[model samples]
Target: MNGPRHRIFSPITRAGRASGQRGAAVFVVMLVVTLLTGLGIFAVRSASLSTMASGFNRQLTQTHYVADYAVLAMVGELGLNAQVHSTNMTSGGSTQCVGFAELVAADKTPSCAQYGYGELNALAQTYSSQELLQPPTGTYPATVVPGSLGASPLEGDMRIEVTDWHPAWPILPGNDATKGQLGYAMVTVSAIGLVRPNPTGMAAGTWDTASATAAGVESSRAHVVLGPILMSN
Candidate 1:
């Protein structure tokens, strides 16, 4: 009998097996590369969003501080009895009322002398001779002083409004409800603060359109009610 037949493995079969293995390895490498790229993109986007949120928060806080400060500054400027050069309403080049408190309830009549008496006429003598307080009218831009709020790189400006508080009173059977609360006066203060790019070389009391349209600008507003200052005849 011939020696037991020995089967020899063909080179083609072995080569085919090696080729299949190589293909599988290439697929694994490609998948790993794609996953790594996806992860990198996600990380970059998350970081960018976090940075933007942080900037917004900082700007908002600074603006709020500026608004509150503006309100307080205005109160100081007007004091309690200083005469205001009110441009909102005037007759004969002067307001009908004599004092800031008096103006609270002064009528907007065509004639300054129509209102028989102003609200706080009793206290007019307190600051009767003081110079008229010339305040800016409407909403006007204000400057931010450097180093005022410590070592802050942030810069900003503000606008403020002051006016009489006309409180509506509940009508009673025997009352002149239209006159509102008599023997008392009140004032309303409103302020808006804005955070924008530094106005380093800009002229005082002036803001350019570029700064006004800049991105990431932030703002805050404050509204406050001041006083029921007692009034007497």
Candidate 2:
């Protein structure tokens, strides 16, 4: 009478199937959310690194420009080279009062042995950094030279050194020293950007007033740059 005992599924079974489907959908959504979160984190980190790099590059360029100015200033000073002191009949055996510019007019190049140049002595020569400190007193008079930059907030310190001078090399066609036209000289210019104040430079006697610079952000890093200068007409 039950027509071969045909079975019908109950609501509970249907309910079980629906729950399973919901669980799978939830798992897929959670996986997609996790992936999106990971991608977002990577993007943020990349942007942060790029910003830091940009700041570092900006600082570096600023310091470089300041160094370039130092070299250019030295060039101008050399352009106005002239006898500033008369090296008395000193140990070098010289008695003349000619400026560096005037030396270009001489038959031979002047002596700059003490400054790691040539050995031969001469009457007139460019002054060194230490020599520039004091006035012209003894035989070795202080010739005019490029000095340290005054106080500045942007840059820490700037200096230029006129290493040596010589007649234009190879004696270009019609190159005349007597006409105040000669080859170029080398100048070493440096610019320092300070991340931390110098204890010695600030206070000579103190030892532990401030800590040394520690590595952090490249944009906040200290820099020391030395640039060579070749000055001519």
Q: Quick one: best lDDT, which candidate?
A: 1
Q: Which ten residues in a row have the lowest lDDT in candidate 1?
A: 111-120
The TM-score between candidate 2 and the true structure equals 0.43
Model 1, runs deviating above 4 Å:
1-9, 85-146, 149-153, 165-184, 199-210, 213-233
**Model 2: residues with Cα > 4 Å off, grouped in runs:** 1-7, 82-156, 167-233
26-114: candidate 1 lDDT, tens digit per residue: 99999999999999999999999999888777666766776666566555544553233122222243244333435536554331211
Worst 10 residues of 2 by lDDT: 115-124
Each candidate's TM vs. the true structure? 0.53, 0.43
lDDT of 2: 0.38
Question: What CA RMSD would you report for each candidate?
Answer: 11.8, 15.2
Query: What are the lDDT scores of the predictions, listed in order?
Result: 0.47, 0.38
Model 2, 214: alpha-carbon shift in Å? 9.0
Give the clash total for candidate 2: 2
lDDT of 1 at 44: 100
**lDDT per residue, candidate 2, 1-233, as tens digits?**
54677678899999999999999999999999999999999999999999989855655564555455444444444345422211211113221222334674665444321211111011123443232111212222243332232221121323333323333344445545443432333322222222223323442123343333321111121112111222233
